[model samples]
Target: MAQELNQLEDASIVKELQRRLNEKSASLLEMEQMTRRLLSLNEQIRHTETIKSEFISLIKTEFRTPISSLLQESQQLVENIGNTDVVATGSHLHQQLLRIDFHMKNIFAAAELEAGETRNAYVKVRLESLIEDALAILQYVVKQKQLRIESTIDLPEGTLVTDAGKMQLVLMNLLSNACEYSYGGDTIRIRGTVEGDRILVSVEDPGEGIPEEHLEHIFQKFYQYHSGKTRLQKGLGLGLNVARGLVDLLGGSVHCTSAPGGKSTVFTVSLPLKDDREVKDTSDGGNDFMFEAF
Candidate 1:
């Protein structure tokens, strides 16, 4: 009787161990399936982003030809015409064509920055002058919106080591965003200062501020905000993301602040300051994008 009881007890122990092992095996299998699904989703997202980048590139390349032709024709008409009326009409058309061209280029640049395809050709650049140039680019938008542009630069006038073109691109996008979100007759204040070894620049616009929840994701690519009230602006939502990406590439960081009324947004970018001896001046005398003749 004792021998029979020992055999039964051993069998029960083995059964319990087998059951635990089966449970663990099932759990591991489920976890593996979930990991596989997540990877598949990630691959799909990457594929979609690639498709978007390619599509935007194609549009930019194709659109430039017609836009350039239109601009040239308008320019010729303005110069060749003797009538004031005809010249004025030609000028209007020219400005519209230019705006369209610039916006398209912005779209292309935004996509390139996001895709990590933007080529950086860093050279000696005048940091102060670059800020001025960027302000000039958005001068037209500011005038159109009747917003005041107040700027202060504390950087020394010399050769600054950085990517001139890329810096200009970042400035253009930030200024463009400021203008877009700002109300007409609002004031856009831009301030630049040196904090230790970093160049801190901030653009403040008292327009419609971003909501607290949306502020965290504002830098994400293609993030559209809709409150079921009305469409705020027409955009591919690539501007801020592109700006952040370029800033990051330039060894910088960006942050934002939105008010409770959701009517003001302030963006700040901090970049590592290069030695003043390496800075070079690239100013075009005056704001290039501002049209004083008009």
Candidate 2:
């Protein structure tokens, strides 16, 4: 009996040792997984830092030319005061100033949005005038690309009232992107119409349409198509992201539709004019502004 008891004690000790060894192996596996996760997070941080640096460099490059032009143009106006056509030179100066103003406003707006300092200033503004002004602001860009702006705002005067500044920014970004993505001499269509209590504005561009896989990701902050479109266009990739954020804040939604090849890309923004409840649809198909690939 004493021999049997001694054997049982030995068995218990071996079982205990096995349990501890198993626990140690599991702990080592967990540690290895944790280390891998940590390495992945570090790599992401490095990538974010690199993108930010690129954005900063792009901003500097964008500002330098216009600022330099403003200086030179003003100096020329002062020196050759009588020789220069006062009206034409003044118009040139105004355009240059507008370009600077546009950049400053967009950059500041983006910064403010990043800092969560967004606040709406609601005031009465005409929809037609607002759109025309956005187009006017982007005139230089359009002219550079040789793109045509075929705008039609059908909403009646004083019918649409919202945060004009934010709306203008939304329009500006959309228009800018339209011009950027379109080929030279392509026509950009901007249409605004009232469907019940909702204002639907769509901007269409006839450039190389966004890929089917990339449509879902275009609005992600600083997201650019690195493969097919990186060489075709250059941007900070903040425009669409900012546009969508502002739309959401303003109780509106933005949608995009594009074909596969070099067909066309379209973005539709639906803003609530008054009612926040369900948009009353009269048609059998439902929503008037369904995203249709052109």
- Put down candidate 1 lDDT per residue, 1-294, tens digits, no spaces: 999999999999999999999999999999999999999999999988886886566456546654776767677686768765676666555555655655655676665665667544445656567667666655556667788888887766542456666667677778878877777888888888778888888888887677889888888876645443322235556668777877887889999998846466789988887764544443533222111111
| Candidate 2 residue lDDT tens string, 137-157 | 777777777888888888876
Error of 1 at 198 (Å): 1.9
- In model 1, where is the ten-residue run with the lowest total lDDT? 285-294
TM-score result, candidate 2 = 0.84
lDDT of each: 0.69, 0.77
TM-score of 1: 0.68
lDDT of the structure predicted as candidate 1: 0.69
Q: C-alpha displacement of 58 in model 2, angstroms?
A: 1.0
